[model samples]
Structure formats: C-alpha cells, structure tokens
Target chain A: MPGPKIGRRGALAAGLALPFIRPAIAQTAEPYVMGSLFPMSGPSAEFGEAFTRGAQVALQHIAADNLLRRPVRLQSEDSQALPQPSVVGMNKLISVDRAHWVLVSWTATSKAVAPIGDRAKTIMVNGGAVGPDLAGLSPYFWNVIALAHLEVQVMVPFLVRQRNARRVALIYVDDPLGDGILGQLRGTLPRHGGELVGSFSVPRAAQQFGPVVARVRQTRPDAVYVASFGAQNAQIVKALRDNGVTQTICSYSAFGIDSLRTMPEAEGALFTSQKLDLTGAHALTSRFATDFRARFGQPPLVYHANYYNAAYLFGLLAKQVETAGGTVNGDSLRAAMLATRKFDLVGGEGEFDEQGNMLTQMQVNEIRGQQFVAIG
Target chain B: MTAFLLNLATLAAISGILASTLNFIVGYAGIFSVAHAVFFGLGAYGGAQVALLLVPDPFLACFVAALIAGGLSLCLALPALRVRGEYFVAASLGLQMVAATLFAELKPLTGGIGGLVGIPRPEIFGTVVPVLPLALAALALILFLTARLQRGAFGRTLQSIRDADSAAEALGKNVNAAKTLAVAFACAGAGVAGALYALHLSFINVESFTLDQSIQIMAMVIIGGTGTLWGPLVGAIMLLSLPAVLSFIPFIPPTEVGAVQQIIYGLAMTLLMIFRPAGLVGDQTKGRSTS
Candidate 1:
C-alpha cells in the first residue's frame, strides 16, 4: 500500500512538470518558414496591405487550431510594385531567409522572380498576379487568384448577353494587366457578335483622360469597356461622364464600391469581381469576413481573401505531409497540394487545375449608388 | 545568405556601370544629361532581342547592344549638343520622354506594356554562365575600362571641357567632338549594364527605364563621389544594399519596412551631402567647378 501511494505521488509530480516539458519538445521541431513579398508601399499599397493582413489572420487561425505539425513563421519583404526591387526582395527571401515558401503579389514581380523560384526549387504562391502568361510557367508556381484572361472571358459574354452591348470601345491602362484584358476582349468580343470600334491606351498614371475620352467618343460605340483599376478607373469614369458620353460603362474589377463612391458617375456601371459580398456569403466566408474586419478595422479586399485562402491551403498541405510521415518541403508540399481535389476558402470552395491556376467563380456586379449589387 | 549576397552583388555591379555612365556625363563632362535610362533601355531591349532571335551568345549580343546604344546616343547628342547648360538639360529631358514613349509604343519589339518575358539565360560554351560570377566579371571589366579611360587623354580632355569648354576649344580640343565621344562612351556603358540586367532578371519593361530610374542613378553618382573612378561603385553598393540590410532588422514590421527604408535612405543621403559634398571618395581638388 505504501509503495502504491509513493507511485501515485510520483505520477502527480510528473503531471505537474508536463507544461514545462511540452514546450521544450515543441521547440525542437523545425518551424515552417514562409516568405511573403508584397507591394507594401507605392501605388499598390492597398492590395499589399490587405494581403499581409489576410495572411497574418490565416496564420493566427492555423496556430490557434494547431493545424500545422510544426510552428510556422512568416517573414515578409516589400517589393514596392517594381520589377527590379521585386527581384531583390525575392532573392533576399529565398537566399537570406531560406524560406520554404514564397507568396508573391504582382504579375511583373511574379514573372521577374519566376526564374529565381525555379532555380531555388522553392514553392511560390501567387495570391494577386493574374497575368495570362503565368499559366504553365513553372511547376513550382501556384496561382490562387483567377487569371486575368479568365476574368475577361467572363466579362465579354456578360457585356454582349446581359448588357446587350453591340459596339464596344476599349479604354485601358497601358500595362500588362490592361493589355492582357484587352487581348482577351479582342479575341472574344467578335465571337459574341460585338464589334470592336475603337481602343485607346493610356499610361498607368495618366491624369488627363480628356484626350482619351475624346477619342473614345469619336467611335460612338454603344458601350465602353474600361480595363482600368484603382484611382485611374475613377478618373476615367469621371472624364467619360464629364465629356457627355453616356454609353453604358463596363469595367474590369478595378474599382470597388468605396472607390466608386467618390465617382458618382460610376453608378450603374457593370464590372466583374472575384470577391463575394461578405454579407451574403456562405457561413464560413461570413465568419472569415467578420474576423478580418475585426482585425484590420476595414473590410477585406479580394486580394485579402486570396492570400487568406493561400495560407489555409498551405496549412492543410503541411499537415497532410506530416501525417504521411514526410517532411514539409517544396516537393512534398507540392505533391500534397496537387493531390488535394478541393479546398473550402474564404471566397468559396474551389480547386487548382493542372496548370496550378485556381478555378473559382467570379461575380458580375453592378454599381447601384455606392454599392456593388451582384447581378449574375 | 550566399545566394542573396550574390544577387545583391550582381545588382550592385549593374548599378555601378549605370552610375559610372552618369558620372562621365555629370561629373567629367558636366552635361547633366537625363537620357541615360533611355540608352539603358535601348541596350536591354535591343540586346535581348538579338540574343533571342539572332545570336545565342550573350557576350556578342551585349557587345552589339552596346554598339547600337552608342550609335543611338549620337542622335540624341546632335540636337542636344546644339544647346548649352540648362538648355542642354532641357533637350535631354525631351529626348528622355521621347524614348520612354517609344519603349511603350514599340509593342512589336519591346512587347509594349506586357513586357518581354522568357528571355533566355546567358550561356557560354554550352554552359549557362551562373549569374553571380558573370555579374562579378562584368563589374571587373567595367571598372578596368573606366580606369583605363580615366588615365588616358580622353579623361584629361573631358576634365578640361568640364572646367572651361571655351579654353579647351581655344587649345585645339574639338569641344563638340569631345562631348559626342564622351556621351557615346557613357551610353555604351549604360547599354552594357542594361543587357546584363535584362539577362539576370529574365524580364524587362518600360517601367524599369523611366525618368525616375535616371534620377536614382544620378543620385548614386552624386552620393558616391562623381569624379572618382571607384566612387560610383561605392555608391551603387551602398544604395542597392541598404534595403536588404534594413530588411534584416527585427523591430520594423515588413509592412512598414519600405517607408522606413526610404526615410533612412533619404536621411543618409542628406547627411552625406551636408558632410561630404565632394562625395565619399571624391578628390576635393577635382570637385565640381561652379563655372
């Protein structure tokens, strides 16, 4: 009886020491390193800020739920939305930080850094870039956002069918994103029985849309397809209305409801958006939206959802690798990701195709007086 | 860390070549030409095209690109040289704008806004030249050539022209020809740098060759010590490496790193200007003359 009593006392003492011992064991496991490259400053800071915050929130949730086999650490670099700086940032992330995964945010940066990723044999996830060229570029490259071509593919039919647009004039910003959308529209519009009347390319930072609007008006098209985004999109819309050109204005998802609020003329304009309105989303998406707003003090942009989905996918893949008795690495993680048939994300349930492009539904929303109402 | 350092070194070498070219115009020749980035773009687009279409050899492509850039510089020099001082600066700025527009509009050649992608990596003797060693070699070659030029009569002529163009012309120096040669040589260096840059990054766009880039290069030259041969290299290294170093600091969040880096860079430049107007390695005696 005395021996049994002493054993029970020893067991109690061991249990008392378990809290201190558990962390020590946990500390021994190597952490997963994720390098995030964002346009944290410069023209695209809004998107970059959203991406960083979304990823942070995702990481927090993963940690809270103990979703990963090992602790995960994220290190971020600023790309500044330029190619040269982007390359430098990528190099630092891969070589200096020895990151296992890199999340890139822009098309030019993703393209510029692709060679590096291929050479380093590191997994790169693109949460924001949607260049058409990115499809099938590298085995290690994964795109979480819908491709720009896909958005245009969805838009052209909407213009012809839903909006009854016949002759469409194109006014797009002169950049890779704008150019990709224009190319897609040119090829798809004729098939839809829509005539391409006139097109004008303006600089990304062009403030003077008077000349561009004048040229667009000369065509006298039934609808003007604007492939601009951000503040420039607002400027173009204002210029179009000011010039008395009242053709139905359709745009790529360049301006959100907030951006359009500043330009009252943008009301009733049709645009394609990858982001769902959180108020009417699935329960999971609504919860994510609520959590994001609480954390960031603002509603999440589409880019935020993309990055959050990426982080969650990464966590699941890492857990799968661990469960299979395999180390989490580029190769194993890639295999795990490829094997996954579907993912439930903040945007919606989707899957990655063979080319690593995400297959997700985009919403065709119409701006109705300071709000984007989903039409089709 | 090694690979990152190599990347940084490669960028620094490319930047050194560009800043040195600027130094030749602003420091030695006192032209203050802002069209250097235009010539740089010419070299990149032209050289990449040649490598992709004509020659598989990157070295030959780079040489041809430099020659093409040098030839193009004469076009700018002809009209720009007709003016003097501030007028010359204005003329170069106009040329810069024209070149930028051409880069954006020449869709067939430059790939327009989509930019030229999938640029083949440079190879030599059936082996791809690792970007790091190639970049270091390029730096060595550029430094050697710059040093040779500085020691030769061309350097003295440029210096004399910078001091007093009238006196140089009076002494039988063809001021116009000297200026033209100087611009051509400087632009060739910029072109060579651009070729390497395009190859290393494997992509190029009009955005990379904007007026802002030209101003950044000029800042490097001024910060490094314009007249000295090694000053541009030092400045290039400092400016290019500053961000990487700041990125390692733990206190600054990644979101705010860029803004903080810019502030630190600006503060450093201001302090350096106040303390060492002649530059870190510039000879006080050979400092920029007001005249």
Candidate 2:
C-alpha cells in the first residue's frame, strides 16, 4: 500500500500546528549565543574597549528584565584590527561557539568577516564599520551605522549650504575608510557647486603632516575636509593650523572628544556625525549614557553607542521572532530585522533599507570649548 | 570545533608555504629578500582577477597567478642579485613599499582600498573541495617539491651560492641564473599559497600582504630552524596554532586575550632566541652569522 494518506491534509495540519508548537518549544530557555569580534588590542583598541563596554551594557540591560524567553550569552574575540585575526575569530564563532549572531566593528574587520558570515549563513551586524563597499555587499550582513558615502553626502551639503564652502581640499589617511570618504567627497562636491582643488593621502602612521599641510595651504581651498580619525585627526589639524592655513576646517565623525582634547586648536572645527547627545532628549539614550558612565566610569564614545545599538537591535529582533512564533536562528532573526521598519535605539529613531543600511540623520557639530556642540 | 581546527589548519598550511618560499631564498640562496609578500600579493590579485574576469576555473587561475608571480620574481632577482646581505634587505624593503603603492594605486586591477570580494570558491572536477583540505593538499605538494629540490643538484648549487656566491661563480656556476631560478621557484610557491589563500578567504586586499607579513614569514623560518625540510612546517604550525590554543584558556577576559596572546608569543620568541640562536631544528655548527 501506498503512503497512509499523508497528503495535503496532513501537510496542512502539520503546518498549522507548527506555529503553536514552536513558541512553546522556543520559550523553554534555549540559550541565545552572540559572538563579537572587536579590535580589543590593536591600533583601534580605544574604540574596541568602548564597543566592549557597549555590549556589556546592552547585555546587562537585556538581562535585567529577561528581555527574551531564552538566556543570552556573549562570546567575544579580539580581532586586533587585522583581517587575519578577524577571519580566525569569525571561524571560531561560527564553527566552534555556534553563535547565532555575530557583531563586528571597523571597516577592515567587517569586510573580512562579511564573506564568512555569508558562507556560514549567519547574520553579522556591523556596528561601526561604515565603508562604502558594505553597501549592497551581502544579504547576511547588516550595517547598523550609516554608510561612509551617506555620511559624506550629509556632511558635504552642510558644508556647501551652512559653511558655504566652494573650493575644497581633501586630506585622508591612506586606507579603505579614508578612501571611501574621499571618493564620496569627490563625487559629491561637484554636484553641490564645489570644486576639489587638492587631494592628498597620508600614510596611516605618519605623524609629520608638514608637507601635506603645506600642499593644502598652497591650494587655499574654501575649506579643508579631513578623513583622519583619533590621534591622527589631532595631528593633521594641528599641522594645518601650525602651517597658518586657517581655512574653515571640517571632517567626518572622526573629529571626536579625543581629537579635540589632543588638539585644542581644533575647537572651532565643524564635522558631521550621528546625533550622539546622550542627555539631550531620547530617554533610552539618557538611560544608556547614565548606566554606561556608572559602569565604565567614563563617558561613552560615539562608537560605544553604535555597538550598544547593535546589541539592542539584536534583542528587538529576537523579541520579534519570538512574538511571531518563529525559531530564533540566524535566518529568522535576519528576516525579522529586515522586516522591521523602525527601531528606537540609543542613537535615535533608526530605519534600515533593504540593503541593511541604517537611514539616520547626521548632526553637524562644532567643537566649542572642549565639547562637541551640535550646530545643525 | 571541527571548523575551528580546519581554519587553523588552513592558516598553518598557507603560512607553511610562505615560510618554505622564504627558506629557499634566505636558507638556500642566502638572499635577504623582504619583498616576498609583494609577489604573494601579486599572485593573489592576479589569481583573483583571473578568476573574476578571465576564467571561472580556480585551478587555472591559480596556475596563471603562480606564473605571473614567478615571472615578476625573476625580474626582481636581476637587480636584487647585484646586492647582498643587509643592502639586499633594504632594496627588498623598498621594493615592498613600491609594490604596496602600486597595489593601492592600480585600483582597476587590484580594487584599491575596497579590495576584491565575492571570489568564487575552488571547484575541482565538478566537486568543490573544502578549503581546509585544499590548503592542506597544497601544503603537502609544496613540501614534497621542496624536499625533492633539496635532494637534487639544483639544491646543492643553491647552497653553494648561499654560502659564497663569488666562490660559486669562480667554480664556473652561473650565479645570476641560479639566483633567478631560485627566486622564480620560491615565488611560485608563494603564488600558489596566495592563490589558495584568496580562494579560501574569497576576499583579498593590499592590507593582508604587507611588510609585516614578510617579516612574520621570516620569523617563522628563523624560529622553525631554516635550511631543514621540516623546519618551516614546524614553525608555521607553532605560530598559527598558538593563538588559537591560548584563546581557549578560561578566566582571561576576551578583551585582553589578543594582548595576552601577543605577550606570550613575544616571550616565546625571545626565550627561543636566547636559548637556541641556531633555532629549534637548525644545526648549531651552521649559525646565522657564519653564512
């Protein structure tokens, strides 16, 4: 005899019953494992430390209320700001730890980890990496922060409209992140009635920007757009100022408190960044900032907010999956995340496009005294 | 666990090939070339482009990459052969910087800072071999070929030239030709490794192949005991596997793991240098200074 009448009727019955059964099974405290790869001990160690603290704070927040039915566990690795280490970390996370979700920061590390995430069918949330290459790169990868080009798009218009910058000079670190910003500025400045007079790339470790500063000075552009970050940003700004080329200086979010502290001369510099005012408005932001300060004993960097947003997003996705009576695996969570139209994160009300790029507003901030005061 | 092991094994295999290639130059031909990774980058970029734009076949792409790397190494060997010792090293270092600049500037071919991604995985005879096993097979083949070369007359000529190039020239040996051939062969090995690495990672950038990588390869040869057949393999295994093993230790915070691993690695290398200057497997009588 044939199969015992297990046709459409039985299949439909099983399909209908699966949803009811799944939630009960999922509610049984199945451990949700998250693996994070950060540059915890390399050139970008400061940012990595901030990212770790963000993850910790996010986890603590989740654990407080038991946000999901399952207990969440985080297994992290230090990527050392290098591709090889990031790859190794990704492999261990995917193959050994069996992490359901992976978080990565930094352009190089994210680029290195994206292919692995695609192959392993795991969802990778890029918290801080904003390289232009990440746009439409992978369905498995989601960039929580705005793409570099998008940030430049926002910054350049502000420069043209508010700053009234016509001729621009570009100075960037010779790396993917810097290159991405420069590429965007070149394409964007022309459309905004601005001309790129001079463009120069300094080596990543070059402390002496004398020649570069001299070259930029010769051009006498309306404003100088710099793409260097951290200590490099301070160094470049100081070099430019010391050379007496006092054209209105502007940069990407790279001009942070660290850079400002190092080069007090950069007090009047203008830059565009994701609105990171912790005490300004959003309750979540205020709570996160307060808790972070209490725990880490220092103000959270903008990168910390990015990672904190990632962890929060992960929880939101897991909650959505649970509510929909679905298994909390990579595929399901990714689908849930993509389907989400908006999320109230610490940064702001953020939305993601189909390409997993977060669409958020960037505030133009001016360094006033020792703090970054939002101008626009 | 299996995937982690496979990844570690693949990394070791790639490192082993690089170490072996460096050994051919520094151990056999006595050329202090620090531009080895430049050739490796060329192979990776060339193979990646070939597979991406020219041919879909990974093996053919790898072969083309090897040929390109070998040819490029031969060209470098012509000028490099004029110098010796530390001077040669400086020349190689300069060459490396130039190659890096080219890799960064030639955005059309190399993809510049964005790098070439979406490289197709290796497929053989309608079957896709797992990258780990393919890497291991490549390692085995390279080791076998290296061993065979060491046993032959070519290897003897290389040793003589390494020891005393002027003396070898006086004895009617075509010293220039031998140096060029040695560089070509060694670079081919690096090319194969690079190709395999590109295929395995399915992504490559200028950052992966740098002076740092060349230095790391040289360190592997030194630590494993150069001039011996098994030395590079041992060194590659040790260097590649140590970090993975250390990562498993409990109580160390994840944030501090990388720094701790680096400290341990540095300490191990320092102690080895202090205790065994000739290296773990190198002959004490044939010290580095003697050559």
Give each model a TM-score.
0.91, 0.91
Report the C-alpha lDDT of model 2 over A30-74, residue by residue, as the tens digit.
678788898777667766766777888888888886888877877
lDDT of 1 by residue, B42-102 (tens): 9999878977787546788679779989999997778656777888878888888888888
Q: Write the per-residue lDDT of candidate 1 for residues A233-326, one digit (tens) a residue.
A: 7789989999999999987655553567446898878877675768874876887788888987877766677888887788888889989999
lDDT of 2 at B202: 81
Query: In candidate 2 chain A, where is summed lDDT lowest over 10 consecutive residues?
Result: A18-27
Q: What TM value does chain B of candidate 1 have? A: 0.93
For model 1, the docking class works out as: acceptable
* Candidate 1, residue B113: lDDT: 63
Error of 2 at B152 (Å): 2.2
lDDT for each candidate structure: 0.81, 0.81
